[model samples]
Target: MSETIALSFEEIPYDWRVPGTYVEVRPSYTNLGVLGFPARALLIGQQLAAGTATPATPYRITRLDQAKRLFGAGSVAAAMAEAFLAANTTSDLTMIGLADPGDGVAASGSLTLSGTPGASGVLALYIAGRRVPVTVAAGAALNDIAAAIRAAIAADPDLPVTASGTLATVTLTAKHAGAVGNQIDVRLNRLPGEATPPGLAVAITPLSGGAGAPDVGAALAAIAAEWYTDIAVAWTDSANLLALTSELAARYAAMGRLDAHAYAGLAGSFGQLAAAGAALNSPHLTLIGARASPSPPWAWAAALCGVATFHLANDPARQLRSLALPGIAAPAQADRFTPTEQDLLLRDGISTFDVARDGAVRLSRVITTYQTSPLAVEDTAWLDVMVPKTLSRIRYDWSGYVSLTYARHKLADDGSPAAEHAEAVVTPRQMHGAWAARCKLYERQGWIEDAERTVAESVFQRSASDRNRLEARQKVRVIGNLMVLAAMLQFEA
Candidate 1:
């Protein structure tokens, strides 16, 4: 009934007949009279999930500090991440070359403004990639020309590389090679005991090649590592775990019970064992805990349970909970079997517990068999039973289907039942509330066609839209409202 809380009575057409004059037949159903999932059931469900051994700690996300610790301080990767975060996206360096008279080119030898040679004894230096003229020294020798060029480069490594010997003419190379003006700096290194490195009219030219920036692979890797580590820590926090547990429990509460298919739908995995659940009309419930990797022993056990095949250690203890009553329809009948919270207890006297079961537990398996006899056929109407099983664990496969077992019941020395009993059970993953919520959103967005299409596709594909569907619909609604508002304003005007 809780599950159908949102479903309108109009949606479910029911037949009614009047046998007595006092009351109308089924006078307007009272909101389905649906009860929220019982707290015991949820406790049992959580217990079922907790039955298995705790999961091995999950792999933590990488952290900046952790990465630094692993890689080292001031390492290439670390530095890259630190510095590259601020790298300019648009700025670039350009290289250009200058040609001078020393590269087997003639110098215009005159202080004259025009083509008058030998007029004023002025030596003209030819620098490439520019129209400006550089004047020769007043009494400069060939060496002084080369020396001046060297001095220019020594001042700035960003200067283009230039050479001026006959065999190795004054050619300047850029630190970063590229097209003209792509150079960063040029340098002039002085050799030992040469009084003056010729300050020749050297042409400074930028080289073409290798002027691009460094790849950011290392930086990205460092950042990723840091991000993951932080995520891992947050995920493992106790507060977060408790909150998630409650949230997931509430989701299950929205649904009356967890069936195998529903569990698979919710958890987002469907392996062979999950398929096996589909094979049976009444598959077992499997409650899961801890977001762990698939290869753990508990996971294997969970998978086995999915197929009803977990090799439970022989539990010699005969401490099963009280058998449930079957075929009880009215609230009066249900009250007899529904024990108050104080009545249940663990062997250690712990009262707090959660219960989840594989199916509608109107009666115990034994009680069902007893009522199945031919003599009881008429009495055994369509009533269902509710049982309280203390489950300690549920296991799962890679596909997220659960398998489970109960803790061995404790017995008294005289073969009488002990004062306290521990019931072990496993419940199925109840991720359906989330999925159902999404399906509702998708339908609202007029994506019913897409929803059906996805359902027909593989299960994994169907799960892919769960998170995005709601957001997509919200976006659609926003746009639709805006359009309507604009149209209404236009019409008013």
Candidate 2:
């Protein structure tokens, strides 16, 4: 016996492991990996300087000045501001704006003033929300006044126009390239002459340009590469909305990455919104229409998008009701929908807002475009009944959490062939457990319901024929918000 000494050796497991390895299971999903973490919004519109912005690139706009610089101080910038203000009302927001090189013509207008000033006076001129006041000497000629006005307008750095004209007429060229320039109004007040103030006349010449066909495609391409929860096309025209819906649906189906919901508004009556929604018939799109009166369609869309983004970024599970729109005014009572009008809107998949007693505008019911489906049989159809913003956030959170969690873990494929197959199957089961746990967390937080049953019905399987492949299915029960109540009062003696 050669010593017959039994030597003990430390047994080390070949499997990779760290002494304190820990996986953090988030209670909720978040878009932290995106360029702009919480308040990211994509705004598409016609930019004054479309050439300066790169096509199909998500540009982060943190300040109004940055938006002005990228888009030029024009209608596009104004739309961006509307969106930014609406989003920032609840929380700080960052807008990613894409300037659409639209086909519509830029509008040009000229104001011609007749007659000379009889006495020294002050005249105020309003153009595109910018006001300029001119002081005329007692004996100043009409042409001289026009020249002074043009010079003054040109001197102001804030006006989005280049002024040019002769003595009696002033020509204002829009800095932005779109039909939005057509909205510019020029008002003259505090004139020098007593006899009708020599009447100021205006002539508007429309700009002819490219059809915005390329714009939606470009925006969708850019959005496909990034992460965003809310998208608003600043234009409210039917053609733009149609193109946007088509592009968004196609891109989302193809990539199936993040869920990007589009917010839009119709400037027509309740019937119009209903018709549009029925024609579109898409769950991914949310159409808002004012029943109280005709409202600024773009502003409504922007405000809704801002609200949706804020809620999703902060807490993806909350509803967007009773949230006050800071800059939005309440629609007129005449414009508000009657009970019958509300029924039509709900049936047609349109969402409307309500004006609170305090004059604050609040979201009534955010609906989706899945209106015609049989509500009794299709659970998905019922999804349209809840707030669209809330539903979108839930879907995004669950999908993102599942994707990120699976991507982080590596499967073991280096054992005996039987062992490898077993390990592969085990990995998915482990993943399924983690995913189920996440769903449970949402249930605990009132974001979802019936987590256990949903997980059991969900599929998690590795292909028996292919050891490397794994497939999974996840079902979720989204918890709805309390939007309505019914009670019967009993009189006691």
Candidate 3:
């Protein structure tokens, strides 16, 4: 005696309640990723604007790597130079030499030291981290400036040389060597005993009173504002990208099983949006849809007999009730049926439907005819309809009707296809075989728990911790799988 017997309705007594499907407790999970792109962008942008980081250049990453490596060896000069060149190609700054007391001497009286270097700007003289005072003398050589510095040093031993240009007068650490109203005059000169030095006068003048502090506060404030603005813009752009990713994820969640034509539209739209998003540096997105497989065993069995029900297409009545409540809800369908030029068809005894777009086929109607007994399970169906027409006639189906009208279908060779025409379509027959095989295997292998575990684990992995950067992604995938399972249920019965 087998655990269960397989019999048709005819073999079993009508009074006895046969094995039928009923709804079971079901649960689902979703996942998504939500990266804060704007925040990252703002951080990087602020760093660049604040001068904490240099402007990025072509190969900037490579140069930064090289600079890091060279820093440990005390040979970063070359690497720094390379990074500088890589960052900037026009303006440049160079280091000359250290400023220390030596090389020259200074006197109190209006002694002048002059050895002009270049016409870049006013000559700068830093001595012991302080400025030395000097005035330029017209038409003086660098050597003459050096000679004057020597003489000043000889006159006053208290004055000591701090720094000197390669071709200009030597600078002293202090402008005043205990002399009241002391002044310095620098004439362009060269090094002592040199044949000839540059004639440019590099002069330094030390005033009597204390120097005034430069007011750079206003300038610094402006710079700070600029840095903040740059960061904000970067952040805004990044935020938009994150927002778009979220929107895409939501869109995919709403997707469902498509008729052949609807599938075509969806596939096309997805491809276009995905490409555009990639170009905008947008994160990749996923969409969920019904697959060719049914839901879990119990769920599938319940759905096959129309017992288990998932969320339905938005119903106007439900929407009205929700609006009366406190929180927002999904969109609802219109109260009245909106008709278009296209015809709708509902397959007999199946939940699947189709929308036909062709000539002279404007509407469809479902006409169910009762038989003496219900059809047997696992049996193929056959039907033939003859219609007298002046021209070729076409047949199409939709959610609630089957359309028969005068329309010609393009054929490559002979009139009708060889019974196995592989036209694009979404019918129960096309989806059931695959579902049944998988369901039987699943039952035999007892893999229902595995499937549930996989889904649950995936959801956890996406929402792992508080940073579910991929929450949207998970949602789309979940929705797509649900759609597939829903479609499978219609035929898996």
Candidate 2 lDDT by residue in tens digits, 1-493: 4433322222444454868554443432332332123446676655554435554556666566666666666545455555556556554444444553555555577777765566666676655334577777776777887898898897875565668988787888766556545434444442234222333333334322313323466666655666666776666556766777676566456266555677776655666767776675666678887642322455577778777777656655566777765656555566677878876787777876778777667887777766445443334443442444445555565566656544444453323333343322236666677667777776776767888999899887677788667677778877766767989999998
Error of 2 at 148 (Å): 12
Task: Give model 1's TM-score versus the native structure.
Answer: 0.19
Quote the lDDT for 472 in model 3.
20
Clashes of each: 78, 11, 51
lDDT of 1: 0.22
- What CA RMSD would you report for each candidate? 32.6, 8.2, 33.3
**Tens digits of lDDT, candidate 1, 1-493:** 3222222232234453545443333233112211111111000000011112121212121333432233233222222122211221111111011111121221111111112122223233322211122334444554544444444434532122333332323344422222212211221111123221133333434233422222222222222212110000001122322333333333323242321111110111223223322222211222222111111112111222222211111110112122221111111122222233212211111111122252211211211111222443333221111111111111111012211111222222222222222122111111222233344443443323344344333122112435222111111111011111233444554
Which is the winner by TM-score between candidate 2 and candidate 3?
2
Ranking by TM-score: 2, 1, 3
Score candidate 2 by lDDT: 0.60
**TM-score list, all predictions:** 0.19, 0.67, 0.14
Which lDDT tens digits does candidate 3 get at residues 253-343? 3241110000000011223323322233211111111111111111111111111011111110011111110110111122112233111
* Window of ten residues with lowest summed lDDT in model 1: 39-48
lDDT of each: 0.22, 0.60, 0.22
Candidate 2 wrongly placed segments (more than 4 Å)? 1-39, 50-57, 89-103, 106-214, 291-295, 373-431, 490-493
Candidate 1 runs further than 4 Å off: 1-136, 157-169, 176-206, 209-219, 225-471, 476-493
Name the TM-score of candidate 2. Answer: 0.67
